[model samples]
Target: MGTIEYTGNHHAFRDKLRRYLDEAVAPHGEAWEQAGIVPLSAWKEMGEKGYLCTWVPQAYGGRGLDFLYSVIIMEEMAHIGESGFMVSLHSDVVVPYLFTYGSEEIRNQFLPGCVSGDIVAAVAMTEPDAGSDLASMVSTFREEEDCFVLEGSKTFISNGINCGVVIVAARDSLEEEPYNAISLFVVEAGTPGFEKGGKLQKMGLRSQDTAELFFNNCRIPKANLLGQRGSGFIMLMEKLQQERLVCAVSALAGAETLVEQTTKKARECIYGSGMPLIKAQEVRFALVEMTAHLKMARAFVNDLVNQHAAGANVVVETSMAKFLTTDFLNDFSRRSMDLLGEAALDDDDVFAKALRDGRVMPIFAGTNEIMKEIAARFMGL
Candidate 1:
């Protein structure tokens, strides 16, 4: 809907992915939710199909696709109505750190596996006390003769249980300043002293494998450090724009699916005098209003996607889009539930699931409140 032109290749890719999800992912959505985690096989299949890390260079065994391919994946995954698979988190958010900052040896060791889906990736940044304010993290690392010792725990880490490798952010124990004290390291799952806690029971996004990760004197070779020492904060800041944009894209797509489902319900649900719910003025007005909001959000987010693909600095705009679309998603889901009344009460109701999943959108990828603060600071308000 924005200025980006979709080539025939892009259209073909989207069509193929849509079919694959219907066959491979959509059917397992309920089972994954019940299991509290998407199975490793599902991730491998996604990787095998080249749907994971499409932007990775061909040198790393990726298709070397552009950012638009990523957008297509996010949109289609949202349409399938399963938030737990977290392909975008692995492919776009976490892998970029490894590709951009990891040393050549590190890239060679992990990038192919990541692209092939043999390894799932995660980023460990949030702690029990530190959510959006990363400078407050208490995790510490100290450099030894040839390795670094890490000590601390991270909670609410997505893919904690299933990740083969995690990018751990910890501060230098000897450094006093918070911002400059931080650094990132690639810690494999089975490394001694690195413990992944049990899956967390969450209010929503139940299938997502969120858990606590403990690093008790975890040691890794000096080569595992991503980027320069004490550059974790800078690296994180540089990549946050894309992370938030991914959230915005997913939120908007989820909202679109919800509205489409609810509108269809409205057209079929019988009202007084045996007329459809859409015949009622109240129902019609609600659907109309939701559609109007979605159209506006679509335009805004699509523009941001194009800007992001072109490598423009749209941090302020992306932050705004993230909060706005997620807020609308939650609002629209709630209204759909109300408008549909008893019809939306099933255990597997699409509207109900949307409501539960949408609640967390504003909280993650930096909270909606943090998004506002960022926008205000950048706007000099």
Candidate 2:
């Protein structure tokens, strides 16, 4: 072989995304955090630049770019430290429902704006008493000839304050099976009976606005119904793999950033102390082990993304990636904090916030325990 080379597009994608991050995301981050929501103007600007929903079809004002583009977007955002803003969730997790299940009228009404960020979208499924087990959800919707009266409350909704439109899932009736009885509806903001409650403060991800939503007899035309009347459960299950994969990608990106930042911190400490933290055999070995683990985790997630892009379903692999990476990130992040000693506890430092932020990785996007359960099923256990 005259020449054997490895030239991947990830680097080019990263460079393009770096420009977008510096130009669009980085400078405005603190302002968005202070506001507890990203400005609609920012979303519209992203849409205008074809960054909001790159995978959407051109007819809908999207580029119909490859999923790799979306992954690059996710990686760049995480690399620059804005996971809380959740652009991937909006583009990958939430909008797919409209693209896949909505009627032409619904698509015609929403897709263009979603592509342009004129309308911010969120999924309303998690309730106060129900999260992983959606069967226990108490939200109900009653059909009235021309519309449905939605009455329920959703808690812990991402983009709760900023969303101009939300896809809400509610039980059809008391007698129906909770899973099968569920249905999705499009609820616009400022509806008469729909109201947003106070923001729920969290341990981290402070920039992400999470809130409670109250729907009391919120009436919307049957035209707002998404997909078949009884298909919400199936749709949610089908979409969960992509959501889990998005989480997996974000987790890996966050892990990579954490490791890179911590390594720099170690070097800086060495420069100051006359011996780097790596001089300590214990710290040295810890870094070695962490580097190996992270490499394997990233490789696995990359393979899973490829498999998904190639039309293979990645439910099992995505769950494994989510479980392994998030759990590892949680522990590894704390260990890095310990290595940094007093500096780790300082709020002004990135390490302190990384340690705090990484704690939530294992909890959200389905807990690590649930991820393991999903993995166990694949093994016939």
Candidate 3:
């Protein structure tokens, strides 16, 4: 049961995806990253191949696959050297909110598009000053007869520009208590007063399509409220386990790729004495240590994924996984750069890009600091 098997059906899936990525996804990475956005066509191509929302139910025009498919996609995407598209953020992170909490009508209306990639989804929760402390958000929404007029701004929204729909978290009232006031809504793109702001260029994940979103007296029907009013905080909390798990998964894959790549490069390079870098005793020791760490992380993350599949709550454990894996990723990237020597100057390239991109793992999906805080609480510290 501990085996991370890519055999049989999984093997077929991986092979098919490799062909697709080589044809469509891989070739576009440099152009998309350079342009600061991935085109809609790439996402549409993924959807056509049933790779966008694999877990969605068949009744909603999806393949109704299990979570194993998601794990494969996350790892393979990293393996294929494409990170900025943020497909997991769509299929796993954002769309689940709709699948879990969206009303029947809402699900029927949007799930098909989501599965088909016509409706890219983004979650709008973080604001200019509000990030991890979601309870302290200043954006508020109020009932306006048959509609709710939302007024707020959200930044660092991935897929902001390409999203056809966004699941926005807003306080129902101008109250300081987030628990009692927060609610989620399905706000379609181009809704009146819902304006898409300029894209915010970032150091990495440049093709992420991140943008600032503004809601100025934005009006949406009451039917758009997800689940129950005032349950937004709870909804977000419920999803944190998966979200953090996703971060951990991606971090593990990134670090794996980095170690695998750097080790090969080290083996190929020779000093004046003609000794490959891998020949050094300390270098050998370091590689062995990293191998051990990655092995443990793989086992731990796989166990948690299995737990998640079995419907077991793994909030604290996933938090530990998230921070530990991401923290290791950051350290691994920096040290790999050290081992590679002058090769570190190859910016705008994979090795350099890996370092730049790896820098973000500690910051996203609630920073590593926040991850530790959650773990401490669960630990009774």
Candidate 4:
């Protein structure tokens, strides 16, 4: 019901994805919600079918396809409004960091399993006091005789409870600048001192397992370092282009869904009055305006993705896309709910979920404020 679900960009690919969602994911969504996490089998099922990282190279167990396949995955996620799921983030956002920047040995050790769903991964960057401001982060790492000691905690991490492997950002004690001093390390699930706190109950994305991750005297091999020392900040900046683009796509998709669902609810409400919302001038005008805005954002995101595959730095475009789309989604959510009146307040209905989910759209990936800063800088303001 969200924005035209498929733009006919890749017909055959879209069809395959539609089939997978109907056959595999949709049926288990509600159960996953109740369980607080998705079964690992779902990841394995997606990987086995070449859906986990459709754009990953064959050397890493993927189909070696175009980025469009990755877009297909994000698009499908929107169709089901599965914001609680981390598949798009795992497949496109985090995995590409390894594929693009991890040492060959590290890639060899993890990428295949990642592509095949044998391992689920997460990246920890936000600390309790340093959200959106990496400069304030205090997580520290020190070199030992043969390993590194990591001591820090990260909050509001996605997939925190279920990640089998985590990339942790730790500040290097030897460096003078906190943000520049940061480094990334790979930590496996059962590392002695690495533990997950309870799932964080949020206003939205409650099923997504956001949680606090603790690393107290946690030690991993020097070989676990993701890139050069003092490079984690640079690394985060480099990879966030894709991350923000994925966010933008997800936002647009979700907004479109909200509009669709709300339109239906409006129709249902107007039954006695006898006019579909589309038939009312005011409602029709709002729909047309929002549709145009979403369509423009969608087209911009598609082009950004294409540029990203061509190795262009899309940081500015990504910021714009994420900020604008998320804001629009939030507005659309409110307007749609308002249009639905009391019906939207139903606990059992899609409108309730849409309202809740859309609220978080502007907050994650970096708040809309941060996005505006990035966008402003890009505009030479």
Candidate 5:
């Protein structure tokens, strides 16, 4: 795998974060999973420790750290098998929209809370009928003098229940072109007509709150419009490079964790002949294959991270990494489960959760099929 130079400060931050997760976050993973959501206290604690939104400017209460800090947080969270908290989505994916496109007034109002974890942020783009195809979204917003009134619903929204604020993409009611009609808006959680639906029961990531959001005449000041009117498509596209990169990082990390755990289990399990399972040629070869694939993925993702941090446009590369790494994660987890047989089915076994959760990786952050489509288009196919 390619090496990422870590300064003393970066190493120090990772060490501190690892200790904190071991103490505070790792212990509550199962409880959060049972409750179907992570507690607000956990989010607040991470924020107080400067583990949230490390990239926001110092003026916005963040440490003004670089993208690598965010990468560290994702890796550490994945290592501990904690997916529910979703710090990456808030810190790396959604909050960037607010920081980059929000007006100074808007930034002043929400960015500090985001950095402090007082405000959890979510981006609502997918509706019932629209997932990868943003242009087909049915949500609509109309200008009404001083306010924009939004009327529609969004489903499969991550952080839906916990979010204090959301960046919503809705179409202008009068615009005819789907591509040009959509605009982004910053809507606080308790807006009059905005309501968060109950958390949906899912096969995986049970602790992460996913729900439907309804906007029935939901009104926000015109000032809440993010960037140019009718520019939501462009804005969403612009930020996807980073979003896909984050997905790739998380997938690769999760794959590595799964392999490490499975290898340890293989070393401990005894065969019918009284030898360790790892002694079996097939098991050894499987472990070796998984490790080799992970090494290649780690190198690719790390290089993309370096390019992204350097301000290079790596949208196509990131999209490829997103699908490739996530596909590997799913395959690795499934193979681990098969190799472990009945032991992997235990209620407390981490492999079950890993397997289930890994299934969604290729589906979200734009499906693997969509990722290939994007890469193909960029490659002049």
Candidate 6:
């Protein structure tokens, strides 16, 4: 039995999107990984085919589809072993800010371009000194006569190089009420004084364009502020449920893919005298263990997604899921790589790439330590 009860249309959509990726996206994974970027053309093709921002309203040039479509697309992205596109990050992570909190003017200005793929978006939250802990952030945004001046820098931003617009969280005041002073602002790329640093080399997800973002006395209209003043932290807290859920789903998908490929290879690989790798008791045990573990993870993630889509508050649960799934995938990928022997270092080693990419799952969307703290606090233990 499967976790998600995908409808026929959902299956059809998945098949169509999978075909598109096979042709237009998957072929260039190695090249993009080497180049440290996925081109804008891939994003444009996604938008044109209705594979991007499926949850956005139709008025904003989207298909006005449900969240499941976005989920399908993300799972397929993992299946193809290409994380650079980051459609889920743009579709579910950043665009929701505009769709939910932006003023009519801001929405009308940005959401259309976002859906059309004319403008790629990113959210800048992590800084050189501060990550997971939002209150410690020192980036400041001061109100001037006609606009707000942003000053400080963000590090380790996904989609940093490719982003046309970024949602920047900055300290609204330097003194007094530091936590309450944080606010989010939409800073378009190339805004004077707002600069994207050179792409940062990462262990994996090389094509995802992670980099540093600098704001040197940048200025933008007050209208760019997302939601009310001093509400950025609250807004971020609300959206984290979805963000972490995305991490859990993608981690599970990646884990499943790696396990599937490794097992298939083991079944056919000959050691001596036509002895299959899978015929070894130890090898067979590992494969069965992975399958067993992932089955439970999938069921838990699927249930959480159902609750989340229904607007139920599952913050603690999703946090647990994020922590567990990420930890599991990291371990699973490492073990799978060792099991694959020297073949794991081949140029086309998908398992090796999965291991590298899985390393960041726990760190991003809040660390596993943070997730444990959140879940523990809720449990009153």
Best by lDDT: 1
Model 2 regions more than 4 Å off: 1-13, 270-273
Please give, for residues 321-369, the per-residue lDDT of candidate 4 as tens digits: 8989889988887787776667778764676776777787777778889
216-312 per-residue lDDT for model 2 (tens digits): 9899999889998878889898998888888888877887888888888777775365887768777778888888998888778888887887788
RMSD of each: 0.9, 2.9, 1.3, 2.8, 0.9, 1.3
Q: Residues 40-156, candidate 5, lDDT per residue (tens digit)?
A: 888888899999999999998889999899999999999999887799999999999999999999999999999998999999999999999998999999998889999999999
Per-candidate TM-scores read: 0.99, 0.94, 0.97, 0.94, 0.99, 0.98
> Is 2 or 3 the stronger prediction by lDDT?
3
- Tens-digit per-residue lDDT, 1-381, candidate 6: 236778999999999989989998999999999999999988887788888788888788788887888889889999998977799999999999998999999988998889888889999999999999999898998998999999999999999988999999998765568778989999998899999999999888888999999999899998999999889999999999999999999988889988999998888778766888888888889999999999998989999888888899999999999999999889998888778787677756787888888899999899999999999899998
lDDT of 1 by residue, 88-144 (tens): 999999999999999999999999999999999999999999999988999999999
**Global fold similarity of model 5 (TM-score):** 0.99
Query: How does candidate 2 score on lDDT?
Result: 0.82
Q: Where is model 5 more than 4 Å wrong at Cα?
A: none
Clashing pairs in 5: none
**Residues 261-303, candidate 3, lDDT per residue (tens digit)?**
8789889878777889889887778878888899999999998
Displacement of residue 134 (Cα, Å) in model 6 is: 0.7
The window of 10 residues in a row where model 4 has the poorest summed lDDT is 1-10
What are the lDDT scores of the predictions, listed in order?
A: 0.94, 0.82, 0.89, 0.82, 0.93, 0.90
Better-scoring candidate (lDDT), 2 or 5: 5
TM value for model 4: 0.94
For model 6 the TM-score comes to 0.98
Model 6, global lDDT? 0.90
Off by over 4 Å in 6: none
